[model samples]
Target: MPPKPGVIPLGPLRLGDIFNGAFATVGRHAKQLFGVGAAVYGGALAVVAATIAIAYAATADHLDRIFALSGDEDPRSEDWVPLLVAFCAIVLVCLVAAAISTAMMYAAVPVVLQEAVLGRPTTFSAVWQRAWTRVPAVIGTVFLTWVIAMVPILLAWAGVVALVIGVVSMDGGDGVSVTLVVIGILGALATAPLAVWLWVKFSLAPSAVVFENQGPVAALRRSSLLVRGDWWRIFGISLLAGAVAGTASYLIQLPFSFIGMFSGALGSANLSDDPNPTSVIVAMSGYALAMVIGQLVSQLIVATFPPLVTGLLYVDRRIRTEDLGPVLAEAAAVPPQYTG
Candidate 1:
């Protein structure tokens, strides 16, 4: 089968189609995709935790050295320099670890998702393998998207900040500042659409680069072209996906908040004179557990939606530009017992 050439319906129906496509795809390939997504998220979270631990461990020594430098201790102390150097070195290592984690997680997006679309079992090794060669392109595409998205945000932020400053520094009484605040708010509101437009335009670049092997500029161009006349629908789908992910994260965090509140109450009652270290560790342990759970669930849900939408967008583009519907239908293997 191949895609039939005709006008593809991309109105209210499109959002439903995209959501259904994601649900079906994830339902069918939940194990493989979820596994890979989980591992990446866990690995990344570990890196973050390690970084925090390292920084915290250095805090006492670093603060001491700062005091030493300020002449409270020995200014000529040789230990201070080495301690500061070590602190900087650890920070650099943490940064590199974080970079590696981000690269692995996003690069895995295409490999696993595409395998699901092709009705193949995705191996963890296969994800690494497929993503390795595409790493540079993927990184570049994402970096470019960041730059593009920042333009409007930067502009809007500048306008808002200027407005705020102007209002705060105004020579008039309270009424003048109020007037300036209102004007700034209006200016920021006016720039909101451009911010949104840039965001949606480059949103699909990673998909273009990974699945299409497009060069950085070409990927962005392709994304722009694919999004043309489709921004509203794309925006709706993206917003829906974001809403789902955000709600899930918030719900997941609620338990930790409750635990923290109870612990604070307990500490205030029992350890009012001096908070116990054991108590602190116990509270932190609960927070850490909650964080891990949230990361796992949030990553799974977030990963599911984008690749699904990207696949749909890919199919849509092929149908429009190359009449690829029938080919996609044949290529898509819907198992007889498909529960997704």
Candidate 2:
């Protein structure tokens, strides 16, 4: 039986449905969506790498001093100012990368969703052309989210530090460590609920930003509305998405990690119970390889999943609100324009 227009419930959704739908959508529109996603990921990564390289070049002296390299260091103690400026510069670059990626994903979602609903190829260029206009909205949403997310992260870090200090300052005698461990566990428990809430709230923010051309607060509000009365469903779906993506990422990066671990072990052997320059270089090389592998995995995972779910949700919302059957039919022949 065909589902009636505006009768399908989007909110208070089932976790299994969302997860299965996301996967099905990905399978259905794998080629074009994946192509665009990969392009976005590549572009964003290149920009981010360039930004980091610029930052490193700008503050090489400060970084060298921070590492305590024994050489003719800068005489000024205020080299930290350069480091701070470089950090900010890198952050700004990251923000720009995020906004660009989000915009591309926004464009990709409508195309993927349309294709999934009515099995066909979408014009990548047209989708991208429309997406360019929505860049301002995407940037605004990213900016707002960036500002809001920092608050909780900072608070969480501060709490962690306080917990560590509290544990260390306690008496070390006779099961005191156990007591402190319990307290630390309790603190983590306290933070877990906040983390979960934040996750649900912001999970759909990207969609809102992409679709609504909204500022951060408005985008968050829209997400909250969409997610209302269905937090567990969204949360469960999120966990499933994360698990699948994480497994895929781990599998992809496993070889790299193994190589890094092997090199690290070799480096440790070279230490001879005393670190030397060769050992340091070997260790740093392994560490750098691990980091590079991690970044690659992260990019691949991000490129793979977010668009799938966002596209599905956009369709789900349309099915719930508008008479999406005809729209989707038209979208089948002509790719749907991202209304947001």
Candidate 3:
């Protein structure tokens, strides 16, 4: 609280104030945030790029062989194995990076912001200590939210499948596929509201898990309690923050896109210069590095905003619910109570 001026005010924040404070929080703590982010996200992205590079390196020759086959010749099963292996490796890398980065983005960023809010000195070690311990619960919260958000799509898929089955069983003729299309469209239309409702209702769960140290289920309940009667405001702020974050991320990432395009153009031009594999590898590596840089910068900005704003919203809810600002202001000066 000693450095309290730029810290969010310890009272109910309007949409305007919340956004203002959200930006302020990012600005005030950008150094620590980005430092922590670099380690967590940078490694994950490197894995992605490395996987892609490896796949390309591993399969390039096999792909060339498949393409070089004579007009009358077909590829053998062995010709497909390299492609298959590369595809599986890419998928595997993606899944692992996704799992690691989700917790780092949602759980880790909020933990850092909460420490700042509590007026504690934030170091990478301190932030990681808090967030790393809660990684499991944070990931569970993420998993639960995704499952909930995908309910509509899953339902539509099921409905489509069921409709097809019934149509086949009944020997329904030409119109069955048309009926499936209609049901799918209706299901999509109906899913929007349901997904938005669930999303807003549980949006604060990640913040609850970090700041309140609640488990996934209890964090869900905590968010529901805090979000009661303020659903619209939360939704509005979330939408606005999403727009701002998306725009900022796009702008930050725009140059990298240009770099990608330029590298690609450069690569395309160079491809005709030589039929040699070494030149091709060099060009491909350059393109891959460009993409990796773009993604890393994109992740930095993209990952910061949502959790920061959501954490502020959690603070706003607490101020309204229990007058939490004064206590948090004193957070660094006091020891935590553990009566529960």
Candidate 4:
């Protein structure tokens, strides 16, 4: 009912308002959102690619030996060690790159939203610089939240593993594995709700980090305050946003996957029975490129939309609990050039 100046009414918002605001933010700031996202993720991808290339170069001999092994001739330690080390190194590099990229995007969204809420325009350079400044704090918040949420998932995995072991060792009369399975299952079930609760409670931390310029722990405590009393509403909306983003990402990637599959099949049809590495690379290049493009697109959606929703939720909570609407409206009335 309030004056609609920006993405949402400068007041407490409903579920529809939050969702629409998120979409509006993306539409208005696509250049900054997608542009910075592409730069960050593209740079990460390049780093990962460089790492893989270097690793492959170093372990090329071991890889050749691996491929040279006959049907029944198992590889020796020398044949596996170099490749294993390279694989572990590559994995470590990937994880580091992904963490940094994700943290940057998370920081960037709230920066964009800060302007979006006030109907002010922002640029890619502004978002990029501000986001980069906050990346370390965002990384801390994201890592802590992830560790909290993963508790239930890890417990469930342990339960599954214990169940598998129990089934495999059923002939042993001690029944110890059965007891372990039961304990794991119960422990996982008991902790799952706690994990979900903690996750939602801290969901607004990244936004707080950027909006309030708070450190990770302070931002988390701030999120706990804002999300206090409205846990279910925040939880449901967050869940819906995540589901929507995930589905869209998957749908967007489907066509690329099909194209890659068909093109790879066609290309491989021309390969000889004992084709060399060059030929194999050429044949599979289309598939690799398509998959890469698909993954990039998917990552863009995953990185952008949910954070937008969460950022809006952070604004909504402030409007509701802290009476932030008039402040936002006042900001919206100012010319973009006049205000910082």
Candidate 5:
């Protein structure tokens, strides 16, 4: 052990040290971490809600026309086109909001960790400002990593689709579908390990982008260098962190889900036989709001804790490989105001 200045010992860390440090980082800086997360994600939800509302308003006439069509009647292109355009616009806005929110959280975690590792306090504004500046680079890293991970996931889904097609075609005696299914399954299996390996290898890129002030590609290379010899360790730790975060998120959201379910049931029970559309909408609004709040809370946990774990892993990797412990120790010895 070198020194105990902060969340973790100022030395190469073990598994316990990394997890403890992650939890400690949250405990010490909950205000900054959760505050930024809430603001970013909450703002994203608000933006998405606004987009959906605007889209609905713009296409209200088209929707009404479509709904009014009789069983034998088909909607005109004009009736459907506006709805389709609005749907696409809403999807585009949602994707942009999700990407930006994810980037902010990724950047914010490392910004907090940078000080947490040195036993220093950070404020929400400081974290937000630092994270906002790094969002573009973090977005690049996150997008690249998502693309890399999606390869095998898409392959697996293709396999499932092929399997379904093969089963459907069995009645028609098509051997080609069977062959396609086999090939898809094999391809997915072959690519799955490579995807996992690449994911772990580049897991630290977002942290590197923030901590080292590196570009996305440079941060990726830096992460690969740091994770090269310790792939299994990092993979296992990341897997565990993801499991913990997912389980905790699910538990946290359960209450809201139950509340939504019960409220929706109650509202439905209270509805008259001839309830109007407006009455139905009002009845379901409570359920929709509850579910939205639950999802927001779930997303908050999923976005925050895993990044904190990964950020600390980034620090642990540096201390282990580059002897960064002494440098961090030295920084920790300085008084905060004087250093600032």
Candidate 6:
């Protein structure tokens, strides 16, 4: 393909081109993307870090109750209040942060990519202004997707329940129950692939909403239309992108992984010697910080890369099926007609 004036080529893209384009998209728009990243993921990481610190503090506070158990007191039987508080804190933080990150990042990336394709530089403010228009559609699309993806699992679970109920009502013995368990296992296995296929079927939804200016319901239909005969192509590209991105993230996180490993080892070793709460807290702190850093980097990769690939897939599908390149080019070329 000849070089185009944009971050990505105007023609249909190869896998290498898609991945390279994702990198180029970020490289060309680092300030804007990173600013968006800082706004979306940075806040979440802060919440996680604060919540984890509180959780650790809770564990440290309850350690005395755990260690002070005498012959009469069983440590297992004791209710650890602080630790329970910590677990709840962590869960709450994760739930809130996950909801925010999932909704907004999906909205933001496609908006910027659309601008990139149009041969315009986008600012963080401009991206946010445009992206906000698609958030409701993005959220609805995501919810619908989750519901669709759950169909297989839900059907499998229903089968298991029906089998158990029928067997119990008929006074069937252990052998029948064991047979039902095997059936449930096979049902789950078969449905897992179906679930993944269904996901790929609707994976281009955000792009449809953003680039094609479709509503939530319309976006779902548009995504299905675009992916109609090309499910395998999208699936293969997605898998390859995942493999490359996952490997890069793992290598980038290796140093932090090593620090976490060493910290865990030190904490475990301390259990045999002094076994003090301070040593446990110190080790746990190191491990927690390392894990947080790793998570942030992983999230940044996810925010930057996967959407770019998905956006490219969306564009490639449109170019092939609908002759989208000329339409986009024509729109970019023609000035707005004014009668006033």
Question: Candidate 3, clashing residue pairs?
Answer: none
Whole-model lDDT per candidate: 0.64, 0.63, 0.79, 0.90, 0.88, 0.79
Candidate 1 off by > 4 Å: 1-14, 61-103, 156-182, 255-272, 276-283, 327-340
Give a tens-digit lDDT track for model 6, residues 1-340: 5335566677777888788878888888878776787787888878887888767765764777677667787665334765676788799889878777777788888877876665667777877777777777888898898789879978997989799889988999888988998888889888999889889999999889888778877888889999999999999998877777788788878888898888777767656465666766666776777877886777777667788899889988998898777766755554433222
Clashing pairs in 4: none
lDDT of 3 by residue, 135-245 (tens): 899889878987987798788878888888888888887587787878888887888788888888999999999887899999988988999999998998888888887
- Which of 1 and 5 is the better model by TM-score? 5
Q: Could you give candidate 1's per-residue lDDT for residues 231-296 as a string of tens digits?
A: 887787778777876787677667766765665556455543543444555545655565567556
Question: lDDT, candidate 2, residue 48?
Answer: 85
Which scores greater on TM-score, model 2 or model 5?
5
Cα deviation of 58, candidate 3, in Å: 4.4
Off by over 4 Å in 5: 151-173, 270-279, 337-340
- In candidate 3, what residue range of length 10 has the lowest lDDT sum? 331-340
Question: 88-176, model 5: which lDDT tens digit per residue?
Answer: 99899999999999899999999989888889887888889989999999999888887877787696867668676767766635576
lDDT, model 6, position 108: 85
| TM-score, cand. 5 | 0.90
Candidate order by TM-score, decreasing, is 4, 5, 3, 6, 1, 2
List ranges where model 3 is wrong by over 4 Å. 1-6, 56-61, 70-73, 165-171, 273-281, 335-340
User: Alpha carbon lDDT of residue 191, candidate 6?
Assistant: 92
Flag the better candidate by lDDT, 2 or 6: 6
Alpha-carbon lDDT of model 4: 0.90
RMSD of each: 6.6, 6.6, 3.6, 3.0, 3.4, 4.2
Candidate 3's TM-score reads: 0.89
